[model samples]
Target: MTRPLPYFEVSQRLSIKEKVGQLFMPAAFINDSEEEVLRLEKLISEHHIGSICFFHSRASAATNFEGKKEVIHNKNSFGRLKELIKRYRAAAKYPLLIAIDAEWGLAMRIENTPQYPYAITLGAMQNQAELVFEVGKQIGLDCRKAGIHWNLSPVVDINLNPENPVIGYRSFGDDKKQVIEYARAYIEGMYSMDVLNSIKHFPGHGDTAVDSHLGLPTIEKSEPELLQNELYPFTELMKKNIDSVMVGHLAVPALSHGKAESASVSKAIITDFLREKLGWSGLIISDALNMHAVSKKFDRKGTVECAAFEAGNDVLCFADHVEEGIRNILEKGKTAQIEKSFERLWKLKERALSSELVDGHLQQDEELMQNLAKESLSLLKGTFSELEEFRNNGFEYLQIGKQNGLFSELLSNRTNNGPNTLLGIFPKQVKPKDNFGLTDTELQLIGQTLKEKNTVLYLFGNPFVLNLIDWQQAKTVVVAYQDFRSFQENAANHFMGKIEAKGKLPVTLKS
Candidate 1:
């Protein structure tokens, strides 16, 4: 009888194709179409890809907040996910681990599910442990239902720079100790439910003003500075044995040999600092390789994949051309490196599978959504008397951030009974005109609203857009932080003295 191969020996002997395949974790778009599902299945089976991340647009059962149409039912989503898993397992050399970036909850990534407050809101929370536990439990339940085993969340990066474009509301806060405290709770919560948690943007992506999705950001801080502030949370969390760390494509000239290279592919940062000095035995995954920060600079030279592996990243995520990238690495004779990375990858998968302890009471429920929404909403800065002032003043026009939802309708009903003079401002985007730029008509309407209304209640959804708005002339400015209906309503109610504004500003708003 033939003896089964030893796990480590088999891992060491994996073909270049199999070794390369272990590195990739691609995004799978899930629409109602059978073709999309078939394509996803093919990718999983043929490539033996390790994990798949889901996005909101890919979900089949999403619906507008007030809309009755369900985009996907929980049972259907669960069933389809299991079917896909079975298909991949049948064709794969090993069991594939599935994951999602469900930071706040599954609703953060998927629609028709309960939506929780942003992480910044949680940062403002005084009860870090309870909130973190709740967030983990909720995320764990939803992910388990969908057969997802990993959550790329609890962005442990310290939000030191207020102007940080990407890590804004995603980070816990700028305080290192607070970030560690909250992150530990979040990790404990997820791990308790058998879901692996990934603490991201290693050595901190918090200080940069630039978004990594747009271009590579360089940090000039020395190792000591990074250790004092940026690396504090990672060190604290490593003591707790967090499952993973995601390296961002951030350039630190003081830390790395070159200027343009990001930490994601920097050996000094990932291998030396994170693995050796910090002694993080957990898996290390790269932030999306396809992100412009790395791709735009290194794709043509075929340096990113090899560099990422050399930097000690076990999982190469979101590579635009997975097979081609793998082929290039193999041709470059980096098969041994690939096998080493695969061993780490397989070990993580095994750990995730073994962590499956359950809590029956922690199952997903509709009532929990309302509770989460209520708890997650931040009061920021304001007074209960402000609500009385708004109600008594009776403003004819209200300016709201340009978003489609129940908040807009509620503001309309409270102010002028229906479709009142509401001016909407767009959010910031990659292209200047695409985000935050108002049309001539929108600009004119906003000007008119400010001029006509004695009580101009401005509902600022995104705090970043506060500078763009003409806050100087407004009678009352309320920063809702987000445009979620619950938040908007809470802001309006707070202004009307129906509820007290208890939330402090999570991030600075320059007006």
Candidate 2:
């Protein structure tokens, strides 16, 4: 791997083009072809782009799998990422700072990588902040193994809005103190493994009804209200001397002096508020510029770069047009600002990536993951002791999950099956906007299962999923809080008396 150039030398010796290039961190993919590799090389070697934020590219043939695939879940994600980093680094004027939105873990983007439980699961293990810390350290180690320097993670948003489409499960919890506590523990753990992190969606994206990826979400709160709720986490992170903060594509009318501009391109939000008022001296990474919230407004060449740079962003991440943005930034005389931005970025780089990408702490231990999953298993409505009697009665299992894979697989080889063992697994694809309640088909199945035999309702979804059914109608209700394979297995073990259901519901269930 090519080593990073000294901060001052890279800044001083760089040509105007390279200096402007140093401000932009365009999005990159692990699955780029040789032709695409040359295009990235042109951006790196010629444009002198500073960094690349890794996201799964939807560039492959949909018929690559001969099917209609919504998400491009690329296999061998870690290995491909490592190779991509080496190629990009080899072509760069400075060693590219590889970054990712590993909010939960590397598995968020990359398939076949280690995945920890969701933030809500960690929230359930509130007393187990130490475990959260351990997992954070593990995530750091995973990042280093794949040559990732910055993790845009540990989302500190207080998830008070149940309707919040993007941040509901990603946030630690609704309580500000708990959110801060868990975030601090996770940050400390990541630091131990020498991985840098960013406190994301600054000024908080917790209370919005819309997903920022889809459009601009608005948060209408006065400065005091924001300081108490939305701004609380960032304040705490800043106190902890956080290395980076990612401003989200949000419209805070009050924060921006009643202007509708999103936080990422709002001077009143980033400069007057985050920088001067809050006194954040570290790097400011704008939320991905390609998102519709920002991109729709700034569609012309270099509009986003001009607005974001002038708005006081230190790094323009996932820019729509890197070459156009670089030229626009230089044309607008922001090269003077580039020096300061580069200095802050370089200082972060020197501390974060100076060491070899090897931290021997908790390297993807399955035992730890199982333990975490088990610890996070919340049998909210039913008791473990009740399972024995229910299983003896030959009860039907009604599973409401996003998919039919895991629970179906578990049922296929059931050893204690009886004639009355009716199994109904509803495969409802659960995303932020999807109904948290049961579908008509699911309701009918549950009704039938309930009447025929003692039905055990095991929901592998949001805690709010309980609202979909008269949970009291079932003989037993098991809430796993998530539908991950390990979580499902752990929940089953808890039911079978192999493990005690150690998790408690993190959020309050709707009546």
* Best by the TM-score measure: 2
Q: For candidate 2, what's the RMSD?
A: 3.7
Model 2, stretches more than 4 Å misplaced? Answer: 59-74, 333-336, 359-363, 384-389, 400-430, 436-440, 447-454
What lDDT tens digits, residue by residue, belong to model 1 across residues 31-54? 345776677677777786877776
Q: On residues 1-511, what C-alpha lDDT tens digit does candidate 2 reach at each position?
A: 4566677776667676776677788878766667887888788888877888887764432112223545555567777887788888889867678888887788776768877877887887748888889888888888888888889888999887777777888888888888899899899889988888899899899888887876899987898999999999899778875889999999999999899889999999998999999999889999888777788887597888778988999899888688778777777755667778878887787887688886343246777777778777776665666777766655444454355566556655553555344333343533444464457776666666666665566666665555555667666666666666677677666666687777777666556
* lDDT of every model, 2 decimals: 0.65, 0.76
- TM accuracy, model 2: 0.89
Candidate 1, superposed: residue stretches over 4 Å from native: 1-17, 32-43, 56-83, 299-303, 328-340, 355-382, 386-390, 397-399, 402-460, 470-476
Candidate 1 global CA lDDT score: 0.65
> Which predicted model would earn the best lDDT?
2
Q: Estimate each model's TM-score.
A: 0.80, 0.89
